[model samples]
Target: MMSGRGTEAVADAVRRAFVNGMGEPVAVSTRRLSPAEADQLLPPGSEGLTVVVPEDDVLGALLPGITVTGAVVVADETGARLFFTSVPVGGQHELVAAGIRAATAELAAEVSRLRTEAAVVDALHSVGRQLTAQLDIDRIVQDATDAATKATGAAFGAFFYNLVDELGESYTLYTLSGVAREAFAGFPMPRNTDVFAPTFDGQGTVRSGDITADPRFGRNEPYHGMPAGHLPVRSYLAVSVVSPTSGDVLGGFFFGHPGTGRFTERHEYVAEGIAGYAAIALDNARLFDRERHLVGQLSRSMLPVVPEIPGLDIVTRYLPAATGSKIGGDWFDVIRLRSGGTAFVIGDVVGHGVTAATVMGQVRTAIRSYAQLELPPADLLREVSELAGALFDPSFVTCFYAVHEPDGHTLTYGNAGHLPAVLVRPDGAIEEIGEALSQPLGVGSKFAERQTVFEPGTDLLLYTDGLVESRTRDLTLGIRWLLSGLPALREAPDVGAACDELITGLTGGRHDDDIALIHVRHRAGT
Candidate 1:
């Protein structure tokens, strides 16, 4: 509060301080104070800031609140008006001003921390969502980079580590952000790259407020990809990027620019935190990529590797999901059941990932065991269902189990809520068999119903939902498409070729799901 007489002068000083945005809805608001009731609002004091408006004129008024040093407002019939708050002691706004700054920094830090925590949690959820999707390296890299950059408030950022080329020599570089490409999109690789200095190798994180002042500059480390004297950087912070699981420093996370304030120790800590998440995500992505490559190799490894059955012309093709991921449920197997006949099964686990694939493997084994017993189709299905229930992998699965008797020239089978298989006969005729479906292998009812028989020389096919469940379409159209596409597959003698054509036509050349096909022709004599 100020004396009404000095209200005008005091108010002017306040305007330059805190209450600068008083009339405008505050970006931040303080406790309310009434300028007219200055005396009531002010604490007991001598005559620090006082003013008094005599009657309707600018008479007298006094204000003493360290929290609000001064004010600025339009003077009226009542004493004078007030607006902002000024400093104190050393300056017009010393004590109060310092307090305001400190409060602001603290608040900003708190908000930033909360946001960082949220980013990490959100990233964790993202990982859960992708566990089944088996997200690839590029996507994980981009996502992790984006989150880190956002947390650090950088223009852009990324994760970089060491990777081996064909020759197996480990090469290190910035690999996350599109920085390297954007910086040198058309340029060829440098013959001898040594921009990065030797000291930077083991120093987990190296930040320079003023690079010119740092001794590392003399060593010629790749700090910002430029000559030390010409570098447009005033400050920098770099942290070592590491393999989260192995604790091996891979690359680093860096923040810099020409800003005067530059980054502080707190900023370095924040950057390091950002790097921690990026490192873990990136490392996992690397491992996942390796695993997928192995899956691809293994998936094709033993399929026909054991040499086809002596009398059967068997062709198997496993088309993985087109989503750039391989964690899928679709599976196919051709086994020699203990009974004279051969059994074929196409199944899809309820979900994907190590879990779904594991479940599929289990179902495959159980189905094989039941088929070997030479029991009725329905009984085999029921046995499989019971086993699935016993080993129910939380994620349910669906399957089509078929045992072919070439001797009798008939195929007996049952459907456990799996997609109906297409059967193309020798005379270019086709039949979609096994219409009846019981509960899926691992869910709902305890067991599925019985099996049906398909005439000899009839082609049978089974696949996962990802095959026909399009973004805007249902399985009805998918089945119809398969039914209509049978004509084209009729003349294709090679089972593999025929399957390739059928899949391409029915799926419009894009398969969002995993497709597993098994084809066997009945011999003239069994």
Candidate 2:
């Protein structure tokens, strides 16, 4: 009658009958099956209990084990019912018949009992389906525990788990059911002390008919807090909650009722399956949290604080891509020039994560190293282009470098496949330093790069593409927005302050892409 949910129903019925018989002599139950199902379970007198009416001629031919001692036949077309007192015979016939009758009835009842169980399983399935559809763990456990208690007729059902600290040596009590008692969630079960401890310890499984009856489960001094044999208690069962990777005993399951002989092996199997799923859910959540922490750590390590220069102001900020996974390729640097000036540089490597950020660091460090020995903006960028191509992928990076000098107007700068930085002037003028033409670094360009001296207090801004290039907008518009913001930035007290103002003005609230900005100011008179 139970179309699905496997053969648990029939097996459970046999177990229930045995438990019932312990209280009374002849507790009987029947499980019905289709002709096909009956063949699989009963299998034609395999248990030697198939009864059939034959012509009285064949009664004596059935072997003395099945012969009738006395009979009065009432015959019909379908069959015959004869009044007969089976003669006493040996070979444990009394015990065998009683066992067969109990087994057969239990199997017969299973067909119906399973039909009811099938309904409950179907309901549980529906709950699982709903919870899984939304991918919500708390809701899934909540619905599953409630549905299971109602379906199995348990006096109470609750969930228990362990919150392991990273050290792997300590754990706190954790649970997820709607139990009213504080002890339900506050009580910590030791990984080595529960009925499930042996299972977790040996990586095996365990079930108890009564907690007080089993040596492994009953005599545990640690379980004194549990009311297993107390006035309100009866039987209990538990399954090992374990780690999928380490097989560590995270915790155990607990189920009990006031009825004697309430827990059985089949119940143990069901609880184990539920606990296994809960373990997987808890594992997934833990992994998610760990990954987030790692990403944050890596991102911070990728951009240490900018090095301090004796007299020149050097400031750099790296904002990782907001919408992307927690890593990006934006980078910047300030190098003190041998000629008593400083090189303000900004560029972006074209990717994200450890790889992109790594390449960005190399490029940033390489620029500073080469800057210490060069002065002409165009020449320094050329050295960078050739060295980068030699050391990295030919198409790896886009960059811009600007060298600032004492003359308010004598600034030297060039671009190699980098966005021309936004220039904010002392008069509140905003303009992108126009690069007439230059190939992006690593792309090999022959068009000679150029440099120009400009006005005093010129704040140059640099950044990666994540700033202006949303899926809906053009990249050039982002550049132009930075260009427009320059007028306000120019009025800021210093280069460091202007960079902050420019970022807020351009990104609205947050920049989706990595944003690296550097500002350079000129002293009016030497």
Candidate 3:
């Protein structure tokens, strides 16, 4: 430690020589140091600079340690106070004293430079946070424009996005802070000519004191000069917003000042940073929208449309978990069996996303293939479970399958580690069918089917566990809630209305898991 301190001592010795030849060294705190405090920092005859770098202050690379020598000085203090030392020395002591004052002035300038850099860093961080926090593209663009205008001290700021059409290209301008929106409202977008060429074509950042005087002045059609109502522009800084991943020019940020020489190189740099962030934000938003569209298409394509069955009203609804892309492995099917019995199936796979969806598709296909064999509920579960175990060994899934036979007035149902189905009788009584079941698919467990007689107007509900399970309650309580909630559903006029009521009551549109529900109301015939 002393060795390092010794180096600082040597550097300080040289700095003092260049700073001044003083009678004695003085200690000065950037904050609260007095001339009398000079005695404490150094001996009476000692000469050096005492710079106070606050303990909490962050210095990038200017100072590596507290001990240094010569022009650059660093030292320590108790609690919040930190001071550095610098001593001035030379043979021309009388003349050196006058020069010492200039040394202090230079040090003050250096301190100001450091502070400016720190402020820029803090401002950039703030802009990044505010930009990514909102997903709305328009809002993000506006905020970025505002931040750039203020940070660069521009009179006005605007972000331009180009939209191509069969009729040629069009531009959308989002302006802020400086000029009134009405000024540009009546004027058509400026053509990519003259001074605006570099920004619109995404060449790079362009900084100019007086854009009108440039050699590559206006040369485009539609307008030869600035429109009557256009905001006066003398100084300008433009940065193109280019997507990092796609390399497509999304837009450009343009800042203008009415006074000449109002902008500098630093302003160009700040504007460029904002433009980069804006490009990223736009890409993220557009990607999310596209994904959501694809997810919606995939969801719609995967679930088979309910078939029309005589003497029965069937309705199905599938709601995915309310997170991410809201895509999960919840599905429902209504197939007319070979024997004219309507088979109702609703299942939930073990996970979410494309993988889970793919698994669900496979299982549904397997079930459909086996349905042709006319196997009973128990036999169907066994075959599907075996198939699932072979296909998805590590992961398992829950499913509820039931068949409604209008001829026998019976409902035969089976459960494979899935929630029990809710049966609402015409007499206002409720029952949970097949409460007991074997292991889920992929577990290779034996299964059993249960049968129940149903009268016309009776409602049978087959659902995935997402409807009856919640973050706060267990399976038993969820079952009880379902049992109680069915009465409200029974009053609905049709199966579709009843399904809607069940979903609205059970999930309230905020489920942590995907839900698949099948509701069938036996018409008054049997």
Each prediction's number of clashing residue pairs: 46, 13, 19
RMSD to truth, every model: 11.1, 13.9, 8.4
* Per-prediction TM-score: 0.56, 0.55, 0.74
Write model 1 residue lDDT over 1-526, tens digit each, in one string. Answer: 4336544444443444443323332122122335535444432331323322112222223333334434323333343344433333123333443444454456546766787678766755554444324345556555555555555555445455566654668875554442444543443332222323321364556666676566645443343355434325557656666666887765656554665446666566666665666566667767766766666765565243223554566777787666444567678877775556777778888655677777777777777677667876678777777777787646667778777775556677778778777777767667777665666765645434434454555556666676667766688987777678666665566667877877877777667677777766553333
- Ten-residue stretch with the least lDDT total in model 1: 51-60
Which of candidates 1 and 3 reaches a greater lDDT?
A: 3
| Candidate 3, residue 307: lDDT | 90
lDDT of each: 0.58, 0.57, 0.71
- Model 1 residue 491 lDDT score: 56
Evaluate model 2: give its lDDT.
Answer: 0.57
Clashes of 3: 19
lDDT of 3 by residue, 1-526 (tens): 1134633553344334343444455442232333444334432332234332122223222345643233222332221122334443334322333354355547656766787888887888789878876667778888898899998999898888854433556656565656778767887665577677788788988888987776665555655556666788888788899989989888888888889988887788788878888888888776766676678778988879789988777778877665457478888888789898878888888777878888899999988877777788889999998888887747668788888888888988888887788888888888878876777888856888989997797988888778878786676777677888777777766657777777777767777787788878887765
Leading candidate by TM-score: 3
